[model samples]
Target: MSSTAPDQPSPARTPQARAGHALADAVREVEHHVAAAGWDAPVRVFALVRTQAALAAEPGLADQLTPDVLAAARADDWHLTSVEQEGLPAAEDLEQLLAALSWPDAVDGVAVTVERVVLPPEAEEALPADPAEALEQLLTHPQRQDVRLAVGVLRTGATWCALRTRAHDADDAVAQGADLVPGLVAAVRATLD
Candidate 1:
């Protein structure tokens, strides 16, 4: 049986919103497996973005280009980039990374994913100093630490985020049914604007 009411038409979704929602869904699907491994695991993330230069490079897409509108972009410009864990700023310094991100007028939207630690800092200190005793400590208490979360964001003015985490609250918009990483999502959105 269908859960949605038959009388209601589906709402229209913008390309950015659609991509954002899809990315979040992707994160949710991957959450469990990453969390299963113990604390402070790392995940790698990337963003897929389009630019005028890219459109101009491809002969097939060139027909749609407006030279006056996208004159600032160069053939070599690329928006898509690894977020972090590829030994880059998206992990080492997200704020700085976002400060440098912006979509050109010819760009329609952007998509990005982030892989990071979900466990609170306190969890790491709980680990025993002795390697031999660490396993025993975790096994005995079973605190369920060491979660790695991956989040995806899509934006073009409006923004939507998908996240995978040990914590999820479907009823909460803050979670957005994808996940919430608070500061990280906001930083990414700021860059897009």
Candidate 2:
């Protein structure tokens, strides 16, 4: 007897089917990272997915993402950008994840910059003691009202850090990092698996 379940319907071929197609397309993109970098290295692909998501969320960013920019980011093994440095989501989380991933002394250099962004307040609040202090110092500095933080980590042992100015709450920054970093790492791992 056939093992197929008779009650189960065949796969759909409509726009909903296109949704699966879209997922497959995304998987193919993730596969490119695995092929180029080892499956064990999650940062490379994670960064790429994050970049793509950010681009989607912010219109006009996709236009700025030229082949050269992606190539450069891939060559370095990591890239990060946002609308603004100070308030970008998950900066702290990314930093912590990179640290956990044993990112090289110089790897993960963030170059892209954006404005009017802030980290989730919870993530900012959860920062490890030392970096939290530094962030606090940056925040309370009388001259600045807002700041941006972008970072990239490469497999070649280099890191890039960037920050821009805008209004932000320190607490929110921490919260954003707390929420995003774990999810990003998990998504990359899921794709790789």
Candidate 3:
């Protein structure tokens, strides 16, 4: 039996298609992390930025990459700007917003910051630890909220990011270590360049 369907056509492989596929990989990577973590975290947005001080302060990454991207930043006076937003922007809004952004000419790349929610291995999805307090908070707030695990996913389709929740009753490990998503980060830099 033939494995291929005679009537079916293969998908076109274009640069955008390639980028989209890369993005799918990136999302999958982050999703794998999210599945392991908990999925109850609130979505949070962050802006990626690099500055002379930021690079100097965080030399570990500087040491990690060959050719020293930060050195270029320092030489050319460029940095990514990070703006924190709740949830995510719609695609149209994002394109418009990105267009409006003022990026440094020589910055590595632009990436959106996002957070994924994670719960501990045994912990159940938490409710308001205190119902009355939760109720009061809900009344005061526009929407109800309580998220335990949050992973940050940048807008770069070629990227996936996961951060453990910073909320109480969550694991520090989940909230730590982001070196896993460097592939997408590098791709973002490359695209920006």
Query: Which tens-of-lDDT digit does each residue in 1-193 have in candidate 2?
Result: 6555677544553433433333333333333323333222222322322343454456576578788655644443213432222323343544453344321222222222222224456655555579768577545554444443333222222233333333432322321121133333333233222
Model 1 Cα lDDT, one tens digit per residue, 1-193? 6555687534534444554544444444334334445345543445444444455456555455466424523432322222222444553455566676665544434434444433345765878899779656654554453334344455544444554344442323224443355666666666556
Give me the candidate number with maximum TM-score.
1
Error of 3 at 105 (Å): 2.0
The clash number for model 3 is 22
Most lDDT-accurate candidate:
1
lDDT of each: 0.46, 0.36, 0.41
Lowest-sum lDDT 10-residue window in model 2: 106-115
- Once superposed on the true structure, which residue ranges of model 1 sit more than 4 Å away at CA? 1-45, 50-92, 106-112, 119-144, 157-179
C-alpha lDDT (0 to 100) for residue 188 of candidate 1: 62
**What is model 1's C-alpha RMSD?**
10.8
**Model 3: residues >4 Å from true position, as ranges?**
1-47, 52-82, 85-89, 92-111, 115-162, 165-171, 178-193
Tens-digit per-residue lDDT, 42-150, candidate 3: 3323444444545576766566544645555565333333334444444454334444344453332243433433334333224367878744544455333334322
